[model samples]
Target: MNQPSSEGAAAETQSGALFLMAMLALGTVAPTVFWGLPVIVGQIAQQWGFGAAELGIAVLGEVFGMAAGTLLMATVLARRPLRITLAATIALTAAANFATPFAHSLALFIAVRAVAGIGAGALSGIAMSCLSYTKAAERNIGWLVLLQVLWSMALLGYVLPVVGATAQATGTYVCIGVLALVFLPAIALFKRAEAFVSAEADNSARVDVRGVMLLLGCIFALYFGVGVLWTFLEQIGMRAGLSEARVATTLVYANLASLAACVVMPRLGHGNGLRRWAIINIGACVASAAALTLPQTPDRFAIAAIVFIVAWTGAATLIFATMPRVDTVGRYATLSPGVLSLGFGIGSAAGGELIELLDARAAVGLACVFCCVSLLCYVSLGRAREAEQDALARASQS
Candidate 1:
């Protein structure tokens, strides 16, 4: 990813607003298709004659692209104007995804997904950067959540049909491509001045590798569990005698809870909000693990789904919300998305492999352990802050 530069205009223009909205709209489409993959894997695999290993490889292609794009945006584009980067990525993803349904062979399809993955990765990074650049870092945080809500809404609308109608996957892919096209024009509209904020020339803050590692650890732990649960949740539910309709309803309920939380978290105060949200995320993970242990009846399933949603949404908000805060530490704000992408990649890889080994209940327990580690790290972080504050006060008194 590129770093923020001092050369760009100080304020955003109407063009930037349109650009942001476009990216947010397109962003949801890809992920909806992504999250819905597990529900459709059997159909896709059967159609494409894919073995488990082959299928996993295809998924990894996409994950690798995402990680690559995220790293590029964070390190390379962090210093550049975001509009250009955003437009290019959206265009690339849209084109690649549009070509996906027409692939004649599994290899062809995987190749298309690989390219699309890179595009999707860049799209996520650039979209996030644009959102952060819109105004003061503080205000952009709410805008960021709002962007997520919009994407989630789009995901909900697109995913339901894809899961329900076997015929919807091709059309869904094409539609996402079209959605990405819309961002091109919006990118043109964002004011040049508002596109890149200048940094202080004399500042020499060093990067906090430990902080970055900790934050990424948090994301990895959370998403890894989610990846495992999502890949097998429906399969497990069905094997346990759940009706397709009931299973679908459970997914809907979980996402709806997540949607509501995404909207609410950003509207709250800042300061310690990230810390509180981080703690909530750990709690959510524990709840989700507990949910998996419950009996597999409709009511129990519904409760479990709720726990999963709480955990999913809580961590997502905490991770993204804390992103800009890294700017205070060093060049991390520019590099954060890439580090995050790397974490997501690791999680996706590990999660996929883990789900293949453990039952859903056991998988959840393992995930909870990871979340507990994250909670301990965060709690210790808070204590360190308190200790620093006490020392500062004493020094001032002297």
Candidate 2:
């Protein structure tokens, strides 16, 4: 990754609003696709009469592609020029998306979507690298979260009114293809006054490979919980005797309310305040998971689900923020997306298996356990970081 000069890092604080919007849009499209898979797959199933399991496999393929693509951009392509790199990636993704609907066989469709995922993941890698250059990382990332939710809402609105299931669906690939083309021109705006992470910087800060792995693992587990919770949401509602309409309506409002957490947390400062709130939010996720799975009326389920989203939104922003602070070299921050996306894929698959093996309640239990793992990992990361910083301070004084 290109490390910026001290001058460039200082300049990052004053980035224009237009640049922020462009970057946010760039980072969010991949997440929107990941989160919207259910609807996309559902539409494909309706159009092609594909069975459930086949579509699920296709979804995994795309997600795996995304993970691979992000890692490639962040590492091998890290030295590539920004504008040209983004243009190539965006074009590749759009081209793949346009080709998606033409696939007649299961294998071919997955292959096409996987190619698209690679491009999309490359876009995400570049976007995250750009965003890290800014000083207001959490706030900028908060806005990204806001955009992702809005896009997800739009996807749900677009997909549900028409038709859908999980990964293999994409009757709307053409729509996403069009979106990629629109973003293609915005690569110009991605350029910065201070170039992103320069490999030449001699800053003595050593890369904490162990800490980075821990954080990456935490991200994976957190998303795994997210997968389980999302998988069983409908079943959770059904058990509460709620209609799908009611569940959908509740989901909308819950995400809408979640917007506030994204707004409020960043403003609270990113030191002790961030640490304190992160712990609380993770705890809330654990509780929400339990509340959803445990026997409950419609009211209880609604409340738990709402809190679950709120915690997730807040926790997500802070979790990403941790990367730059942990690995100042910026090497690991770039790889975080690959791990994060991979986690979501694995988590979703695990949830599906748990549901079949036992029941929705069992899936919910898995979500709770995943959340616990993430929370514990987060705590360890915090303690290790503080110890390192303290030692650095002592050495500087001596």
Candidate 3:
């Protein structure tokens, strides 16, 4: 009897798999509530009478927890059932977010946010794993990026402001908690999507551990630069004399630019062009960081914001897309989020300290340095991969 080909089985499950991917992607970004916290950290600090360092500590707690969760998923939980993992993580995240509103002390707030991060990290790992199993990672990830941008626009541009305006930090946490609950219904779809992985060709090929490590290093450095800028972007704008509202408005345009990139990226196809695009994106990021260091005029700041978002989104999506190709088993893909989160945690704390000790310009300078380091790591990884492929071709020919 003829057996169904892997490609044929994949086609059969494509629609359901994509749907599950979308849910997981959405779950992946649902944790952006933590990202948004920096936007209102000033208000929280004033309410609590905490300094920049203290606020940073709180943020670091959540970031560490997220990294920890991702590490667990990539290692210990790697063999767990997707459906069970997703459900358990989402439930825990929702509970932590719900409790965030009640945290009065700095210690309590940090603890709860850390708890939320653990759950969020696990969810992100599951999402990345599922996405890695798909036939077209770049296109699917582009779609995921678009979903994330739209969600961010809605939450940051409207919901958080409106709700937080009335109830302050409490209102923000409440909205995040409620939003987390919305994903509970999506958990069931994971079961149906399990077939996507089963249908994949048995890639028993050994992974290039050293090469993947370099790539992960690049991811960490790239996001570290991003974390430095992103965590303090609004505050930096205000320091440059823009009103809070103006900063928010500028960020809206940035998000829009990111959305446009998401639309365009998938159409570009997954090919050698990915590396070229990555190079271009990193250059743009460095340029954006440099521009931010210039005089903070409205026009200059707005343009830089747009440039940063477009470049960052494109680069990040490419990294996510490229990881599956690097390690077919999705091991690196599972670890990518954790590595990026760890970078973010370190960058955020370090950026905050730089701002306090030196100035905003110093933080921007550090970000540029991180981007350059990332570029170097990426170039090395590319060379290693090319050599490996060439060697494999030679062996086959012989």
Best by TM-score: 2
**TM-score-based ranking:** 2, 3, 1
RMSD of each: 4.4, 3.2, 4.0
Model 1, residue 219: what's the lDDT?
A: 64
lDDT of each: 0.60, 0.76, 0.74
Poorest stretch of ten by lDDT in candidate 3: 1-10
Give the alpha carbon lDDT tens digit for every residue of 46-87 in model 1: 555678777777777777777777766656665566567667
* Candidate 3 lDDT by residue in tens digits, 1-398: 00112334333433475455565555446567655664567557655676776777887788888888878777676655566767788788889988887788889988998998888777776666566556676777788778876766666667667776788777676666676677777755544434223323324445578778888888899889988998899988998899999999988778878888987876664777887787778778889988999889988999998898899888877777777656655555667777888897788778888998999989988998998888788778788889988999999999
- Residue 244 of model 1 has an lDDT of 85
Task: Tell me the TM-score of each prediction against the true structure.
Answer: 0.78, 0.90, 0.85
lDDT of 3: 0.74
Off by over 4 Å in 3: 1-14, 17-25, 39-51, 192-203, 234-250, 294-302
Predicted structure 1, TM vs. truth: 0.78
Provide the lDDT at 265 for model 1. Answer: 62
Cα displacement (Å) at residue 320, model 1? 1.4
